[model samples]
Target: MNDQGQGITVVSLLLAGLLLYGGAGWLLDSWLGTRLFTPFGLILGSALSIYVIVKKMGGVKS
Candidate 1:
């Protein structure tokens, strides 16, 4: 794929990660009556997404 396509894929993966995990966290907070999972989920999601993207991209070019 071209650079543009790869860029789009990366953005999509990041958004999906944030939304999916964040949503889960929100649900958990509502269910358990807590107030901390959302941020935690967002952070976790971001980290996991970065890890996946790096692996998929075969690590840094330089």
Candidate 2:
């Protein structure tokens, strides 16, 4: 993929990770009555997204 394609892929993955994990965290917080899950979810999501981005882009050369 080109640079623009890579950028779009990374952005989409990050956004999807954030929404999916963060939403799960929000639901967990609501169910468990805790305040820490949301931030945890966001951090986890970001980390996972970065991991995915690196893994996906690792095989490609410039």
Model 1, position 53: C-alpha lDDT score: 83
Worst 10 residues of 2 by lDDT: 53-62
TM-scores for all candidates: the values are 0.89, 0.90
With candidate 1 superimposed using the best TM-score fit, by how many Å does residue 14's alpha carbon deviate from the native? 0.5
Lowest-sum lDDT 10-residue window in model 1: 53-62
Superposed model 1: Cα runs more than 4 Å off:
60-62
Alpha carbon lDDT of each predicted model: 0.88, 0.92
Give the per-residue lDDT of model 1 (tens digit) for 7-58: 9989998998899898899999999999899999988888888888888886
